[model samples]
Target chain A: MTPRLAWRLLPPLAVAALLVAAWQAWVTLAAVPAYIVPSPRLVAHTLVADRALLAASLGITLGVALQALAVALVVGVLVAIAFAQSRWIEASFYPYAVLLQVTPIVAIAPLVIIWVKDTHVALVLCAAVVALFPVIANTTLGLRSVDPGLRDLFRLNRATRWQTLTRLAIPSALPYFFGGLRVATGLALIGAVVAEFVAGTGGQGAGLAYQILMAGIQLNVPRLFAALVLIAAAGVVLFSCASLLAWLALRHWHESELPPR
Target chain B: MSAAPVLAVDAVGHTFPSGTTALTGVSLAIADGEFVALLGPSGCGKTTLLSLLAGLAAPTAGSIAWWGEPLPPPGRPFGYVFQAPTLMPWARVAANVRLPLELRGSDRATAQRAALAALARVGLAEFADAWPRELSGGMRMRASIARALVASPLLLLLDEPFAALDEFARNRLDDELSHWWRDAGFTAVFVTHSIQEAVFLATRVVVMAARPGRVIADLAIDAPFPRGPAWRASPAFATLCADISRRVAAAAERAA
Candidate 1:
């Protein structure tokens, strides 16, 4: 790795190592029971022992989160475009969209589980619901933020509706869309875990949340800590991916992605 | 000169939606190949008149005709340069210049050639790939001018385009604009508050006054072309500038 990259990463790693060392020291010094709060060494041992089961559950959970995000991105943009096309349509429908967004996903997940036959599909649908609003809101605002002078220029040249939307509105909305993507990535994972908790599915179609639930019942505290670490890592990875996507798309022109002078 | 009237504004007046009167009884018949400057102080409806001529807006009281037809005759395009560069912040300089041709659905190869030629004309040939934010204020305005002239429209309208630039940039652009006008021989209407600038470029200076804007004088500028800094420094140039300045001051006083 380059010296710059190593230097940039140093502080965060330093902080995490200090925290882990303190946790290990406290558990050993206090003689705390493993079931109550597992030591760092015990949690690491559990993670290695339960690798196959945890990895399978993690794969399932991540698949659901990623798929839900994709669905939200595509559907949200289309809805935003429809809203952009007409104020009347937006006026009529936007309130309902906001209503859907504000309603707690956890409160709604049980109903979603009951309504859908397949538990996995229900989980994806619930996650998509939770992640949809940011995309719609940001993209709609960006579409409406077109410069008046640019609009006049387009009109003077007799640009068609499609041409204006594709050339002007879409390109303008990209920065905002990527911003929405970052928020939605985290929300999608939260939605998936909540929906799984509500459904309480186990055995063959189990996710990380199910593993956590099972470990909690059995008082397998080290295993539970291992599962929590996996979830946190997954969240961080997903967020990083969204940021990378945004940087790749906007680095050349956008103000946000340019290196600070 | 009684040449064909390229654009005729017959007693035009405008009141904006905000209930502010911008123009009153503004009538003019611009002849072919004339470089007319709408010289006035701000709020004199110089820009309002230019917008009407560009067909961006309609007059509330009267009509404007293009080539003896209604304003903005379809398929007959005109060039327009706004005060701001107005380049898409995301696009490269060449893409911004190429926009008009691309909007009209010209093919890729042809549009590329024309865009390069236009960039070269504005002395920005090498900066074609650079972003707008990379360029200085003067260069951005030059890119805007290049975009305006890229399609080679028959009538060009510029609304105080160099107002925000430094004096040196302003003077340099003014000289370049005079050369472009002389070479192209297009009907041009330039709006400005600077009396020296109006006298420097226009074949005729149409002086106006504010507070419900109206024309007060039409002075013919019979100065020789190929004007440079030497010409601007001459007594003849100073006399013309002084004459127009007095007329503008008198007109402002009359309006008050």
Candidate 2:
């Protein structure tokens, strides 16, 4: 990495280290019960011991989240494009999309589970619904919000609607699409966990949610902390990956991704 | 000389939906290779008339034709440079300049070569990879002009393209644009409020009246090509500027 990037990465890395140190020290100094908040070292040990189970559960959860994200991206972009092209379609469906967004995922996940029957299907559906709004909203806004002068220039050049969208609107919407994806990445993970929590399933019992619950019920605090750590790590990894992708795509051109002086 | 006029605006008029009349009975005929400046006060519909010629907006009355053909769909007939440099912020200078060619379905290599040549024409060949934000205002305008000229347009329409620049930058661009116009030999219809700019760059300056714009006078500059600062200090230059300024003041007064 360049010195500029290394300098930027340093502060966040330091903060994370500080947080881990604080957690370890607090657990030891306060004589806190492991069942309440396991020491960072104990959590690390538990994670190593339960690697097979933890890895399996993490794989399942990641799979579900990724599938949901893919669905959200495809459907959300199609919907956004529809809204961009037709005022009538936008008027009819945009409010319904807003309704979907405002409706609580936890409240609706159980109903989706009941309706879908299959646990994986239910999880994917719930996650997709939860993540759909941002992509649609951001992409649509980007499509419609082109500079008027550029629009005129394009029009004067005899650019067709498809030409405008592919050459201009879609490229313009890229930052916004990635903005939505960053938000949706976390939401997809949350949706998978929430759906698994609501709809208990057996036979390779789906994802980290089941493992977390089992750890809690068995009074295995270190294991519970390990599972929680995995979830948090997954979220951080997703966020960092999404942010990196955005930076890579926009770094050369967009102001948002410009390296510091 | 026997060819049809490159662009003809036949008694065109327009009014906004809010009931504000922008133009009334504005007629102009531009031959191929002609450079015309529409000089007027702000809100005099000079830009609006250019928009009509560009086919961005339909005239409320009468019509505009290109080379005896009715204006092709709003975007196909001419290239336009707005007052602001409307380079896409997310695109590289090369990508921004290549937009018109891309829209026209040219292959990437062909587009890249044309875009590079156009950038070289505007002295921005070195900055092709830079983003719009990285460039100075004059550089951005150069990119905009490069984009306009890349398609080898039949007609180039500009709306006060240099009005925002400082005197030094503006005058330099004026010289560059005049050179480009002379060599490229495209019909140019430039709209500017500056009497100096009108006289310096145009073969003919069409003075416009304000508030429902109408052409008040059409004065031929009859100056030689590659007009420099020395030309600006010449007696003929002063006479034309003074005459146009007087006409503009009279038009503004009539509107008031």
Candidate 3:
């Protein structure tokens, strides 16, 4: 990596190391029971020892989040475009969209699980619902935020509605859309975990949330800590993926992505 | 002046929904190949008039004819340069210049060629790949002009396109615009609050008054083609400027 990138990575890694060291020192000095607060070494040991079970669970949770995010991106953007096509349509549906967002996922997840027999699909649907609003809201604002002069230029050229949206509005909406996507990705992960907890599916295809739930009941604190660690890691990785995509798509002209002049 | 005018605005009037009158009894017939400047102070409805001429809005009273047809929804293939450069920040200069043709359903290759040619005309061919932010303010304005000229428009409308630039950049653009008009022989209606810019570029200056803008004086420059720095430094230029300045001051008095 370049020196600039090295600088960025080093500071975060150093802080993490310091936190781990502090945690271990406290655990050793206080002689705390591992069930109450596992030492950093014990958590690391449990992470390796339970790798197979934890890895499978991690795969399921992350898979659900990713699928939900993908579904949300497609549906949300199309909905936002439809909103742009007519103010009447936007006025009618926008409030319900806000309602979907404002209602907590846990409140609705149980109802969704009961209604949809296929638990996995229901989980994905629940996660997608939570992730959908930002893309729609941000993209709608971006579509409306067109420069007035540019709008006139399009009108002057007699651009068709399709031409205006694809050539002008879509490109204009991208930075804002990516911004929404970043937020949506994190929400998708949180929603996925929440839905899995509510679903309580435990047999062969149990997710990390199920593992975390079981570990807490069994009081296998290190295993619970391991599952929590995997979730945190997954959230960071997913968030970074979104950031990288935003930078790649927008580095050419977007102010947020552009190098300083 | 030509026997048949390109644009005829006959006793046009406009009132916003809020009941502010923007234009009143505004009649103008712009002949083919004439560079007309709409000179007035702020709130004089110069922009509203231009928007109307372009069929961006319909007048509340009266009518307009473009190339002998009743105003708009019939394609006249005109270009408009807004007060701001208004290039799409996301697009390269070439793509931005090609926008009109692309909107007209021209094939990509043809539009790209026309874009490059237009950029060459505006001395921006080399900068066609640059983003709008990569360009200086004057260069960005040049790209805006190239976009306007790319499709070989019949009429060009400018709304104080250079007003934001420094004096040097503004004068340079004015110089290039004058040359482009001379060589291409297209109809142009330029809107500006600057008396000097109006005097320097327009074949005829249509001085307008505020408190519901109406034409105050229409004076033809009667100067030869391709006026340059020599013309600008001459006593003739100063005389014309002084005359136009007096009319503009009278407009400010009326508005007050």
Candidate 4:
């Protein structure tokens, strides 16, 4: 990285470090009760002690979320292409998609569990639905929003519809697709956890949500804080991965990925 | 002169769905290898006529034909450049130039070679991998031209391609474009508001009246090819510009 960009990044890094240090100091200085507010050191100890359990739960959550996200990416993009092809299809189906987006996933998770009759499948379906809309909306908008002049230029070249869609529309939609994916990555995680929360864990094993609930019930505040930290870390990892994918896909040509110099 | 016309615009007219008429009973014919300029005031249907000729839009009345074959399917017979560079922002300069070839199912290697050749023609080969955002306005326009030229279409339609450029860039591009057209041997229909530009680039200038656009005058420049700055300062060049300017002013007055 250039010195300027490195320098610019320092302030945020320093602030985050300061916040962590302050949190550690405050928790230690107060001699807070573990149930009320576990110290960072205690949380760390709980994490190491319950390493096996935490790793298993994290594996389960990650597996479910990634499966749902994969499904959403495929189905959402296909549906978006279908919508882009025909105004009538867009008119008929887009509102239902909006309906799905607006409807609360928490309210629907139990219903999905009951309907699907398989815990893992139900969880994946609910998470997929939660993560699917942004991809559809963004990709569709990108596909249809091409410059008329460019479209004309393509037409004048005798480009087939498929060629136009694949060569022009899809590439044009990529940034938007990645934009949706970034949003959906976080949503997929939340949906997986919430589905597990509502559906009472099954399939492979319990997830982080179950651990949190169990820790809360047992009044193991250190474990609870540890689970919470794991969840936050998982979220950060998901966001970073999604952001990295976006940067990789767009960095060479797109303005969004231009590196500071 | 003895053979069939390369392009024929037969009593073409256009009225938007909003019920505003842009052209009325406009007609013209262009020979093969001709460079024709559609010159007029703003809103005089010069672009409308070019669009009709390019098959971007069908004339509400009358027909346009190419070499006795009706204009191919609204988009196949010609290449077009809009007033704006209109390069896709997401693509690199090479990718932008390769668009038409890629659309036509050219393989990556073939497309890359063609894009490189076209970019070299326009002196932008070095910036091929750079994104559109990185290019200056003139370089972007050159890329647009390279794209239009890459397909090797019979007809080239330019809608004020240099209207937005600085005077230096515009004049330089005009000289370059004239040379390219002479060498490429393609029929060109350029639209512009500048009388001097029309005189400088075109063999024939078709001046139009405003609102419900109609041809008011057609003047032949009769200038030699590869016109340089010296030609711009020549007495004959000024006479042609002044004559076209007078006709354009008269057309504007009649519309008012």
TM-scores (chain A) of the candidates: 0.96, 0.96, 0.97, 0.94
Residue-level lDDT tens digits of model 1 in B1-256: 2345889999999999999999999889998889999999999999999988988898999999888888576666778899898899889999998898899888878887898998898899999999998999999999998888888888899999999999999999999999988887788999999998998999999999999899999989888898778778989889988887888888777767
lDDT string, candidate 3, B2-39, tens digits: 36579999999999999999899999999999999999
Query: What would the TM-score be for candidate 2 when compared with the true structure?
Result: 0.94
Tell me the tens digit of each residue's lDDT in model 4 across A116-221.
9778899999999999999899999988877788788877777798888987888888888899998999999998889889987844579988888888899988
lDDT of each model, Cα atoms only? 0.91, 0.88, 0.92, 0.88
Identify the runs in model 3 with alpha carbons over 4 angstroms from their true place: B1-3, B73-75
lDDT of 1 by residue, A48-80 (tens): 999999999999999999999999999999999
Please give, for residues B1-256, the per-residue lDDT of candidate 4 as tens digits: 3376878889988999999999999889999988999999899889989888877788899888777777664434467888999998877899888888777778989999989999999999899999898899999999999999987777899999999999999999999999899888899999999988989999999999887889999888887877888899999999888888887787777768
DockQ for all candidate structures vs. native: 0.69, 0.73, 0.89, 0.66
**Candidate 4, B-chain TM:** 0.96
Cα deviation at A47, candidate 3, in Å, is 1.2
Q: How far is candidate 1 from the true structure (C-alpha RMSD, Å)?
A: 2.0
Candidate 3 - chain A - TM:
0.97
TM-score to true structure, per model: 0.95, 0.94, 0.98, 0.94
In terms of DockQ, which candidate is stronger, 2 or 3?
A: 3
Candidate 2 residue-wise lDDT, A133-243, digit = tens: 998999999788787888787776678998888878887888888899899999989988888888765449658988888888899989888988899899989988999
Off by over 4 Å in 1: A1-7, B1-4
Worst 10 residues of 3 chain A by lDDT: A252-261
Candidate number achieving the greatest DockQ relative to the actual structure: 3
> Which residue pairs show backbone clashes in model 2?
A155-B75, A156-B75, A157-B75, A158-B75, A158-B76
Error of 2 at A246 (Å): 0.5
For model 4, report DockQ. Answer: 0.66
